[model samples]
Target: MTRHEETGAALLSVLLLVAVMAVIAATALDRLTLATRIAGSAATVDQGRAYAFAAEQIALRRVGELVRRDPAKLTLAGDWLGRDFTLPLPGGTGRARLADANNCFNLNSLAAETAPGRLSQRSGAIAQFGELMVLLGIDRGEALGIAGAAADWIDSDGNDGPLGAEDGVYRSMQTSYLPANRKMADPSELRAVRGVTPKIYARLRPWICVLPVADPVRLNVNTLAPEQAPLIAMLMPGQIAIGDARAALAARPAGGYGSSVRFWEASSLARLDPGDIAEQTGVTSRWLALTVNVTMGDGFLTAESLIDANGGAPAAGQAAPAIVRRDWGESD
Candidate 1:
């Protein structure tokens, strides 16, 4: 080969080597930048979580003090039922709200275990639920069906109620699964029941809850909002109208009734016999929920804690209110 051609070949080889090195260096730098961002995001999330948990502790202490101070009743006089507060953190901020969690229908009330793991439908609760559904615009027949299905979902036996489904029915579905045959850990589980469509679930979400136990629902009359009059109406069905229920709630004393008896004795509510529900209804709350939201750097965290004050007064020198459950990511 000629000298000139040889020289050109050498230069081309050197250029190609430089280009390859440049590509490798660029890829390494890009990877390092991505790794740094991921590490930073993780750290921020951890910090936010720590702040959220600290806020929950503060809420627990406050609730304990309130319940201990006045064991007889919990009132809305101080606007404490749905109180919201904010806290300043070193490099972020936290927001929290406290709410009475028992002022809703308990879906678990539809059935209670007659024997260990054996559940039987509670006619009264099912009737009340059916009434609530009807008041909410659901067809009466469909409402009863949903209630029956809900009961069957929690019962231990394979037998289904009149309008309910069993494991066999579920197994035959396009996407198959079996009934829980157990108490629901959360209200969202209702979405899995046979008759609860997404729309129906959304409609019912605001007025119902799932307590761990299957005992009858005990709504705190003192905390019921005027907008929640349907809950009161459902309890007695034909006896009370929604407007009357709302008016009664609106007329409640600022500090709440001195006792459940006083609540039942109110002029507007006195005429109707609360009957079986009289024992189930009360003016004191047993459960409260605290929602905490924390933001740190670019990270955000949300958490909810369920506080069980054991209802009514704690024995003298009893331990502080207990946090029975905690959940992250969403609020119910």
Candidate 2:
């Protein structure tokens, strides 16, 4: 080949090499930028979580202070770190709220014999649960059976009713799934109980929850949605329509039920079976689930807090308060 041609070819090869190197450099830069962005996002999420935790600590401190001042005023709120708060809970994003631990049932208290055998433990509350089950399209017998199974699952025993899933029954239904004994650790555990179909669970999810083994069963009238009051009313024998319950409640002025005691003692309860009413109502100290909607500037964070309400002080700057569950909820 001629010298000139050879020189031209060498130059071409060098140009090609330069192009390749340029491509590699560009790709590396893009990757570095992407990684940095990812790291920044992670840090932001971490910061938000940290802030949430800080807010929880502030909430607990406020609860202690409020209770010390007036235990009956547990549902009051105060401002902290630029956020407004409350209990029975408060109202802001990145804020924590407390529910009276006394407002729910300790799954541990459920027993085939001693449990009121009522749906909601009020008067005809079980009948209301049965109604909801029917409303949700489950058969009456199936609905009651599902409740029985749920009761059996959380009742600290292995005894199985005809419809309940003891270990043997659960093992027979599905090869991969097993059953649990003793009390449930969380309300979600109910999904694992036999006879509780997914659809029924979906219907009950918003209204029901599991409390600590040490807690007691008490319905919170203030927190209950319209759908739940019927069940509470149904545990008694008198017929209770959802409309009737809502109307009776709406008739009462603000400050939902006077004291928790007065809440249950209303004249509407006179029609309910006293024995069943006694067993199913009232709260305990160890567990609570509160649905709090908070407004932070222009944004909103609606959160449900499952708390362990005790007398001890929380550590500084941290609300590591006993959390059975803390999860994101949709805005109302």
The best candidate by TM-score is: 1
- Please give, for residues 1-332, the per-residue lDDT of candidate 1 as tens digits: 99999999999999999999999999999999999999999888888778887887888778777777676677776677777798889988889998888888788888887877777878788888888998998889888899888888887778988788889989999999999988888999999999899888888998888776688887777888889989888888778888888887888897887776777777778887776677766777788888898888678888888888763335422566777888888744
State in Å the error of residue 331, model 2: 12
lDDT of 1 at 243: 86
In candidate 2, how many Å is residue 303 off? 6.8
Give stretches of model 1 more than 4 Å off. 1-4, 115-118, 311-317
Count clashing pairs, candidate 2: 20
Encode model 2's per-residue lDDT on 2-39: one tens digit a residue.
99999999999999999999999999999999999778
TM-score of each: 0.92, 0.67
Q: How close is candidate 1 to the true structure, as a TM-score?
A: 0.92
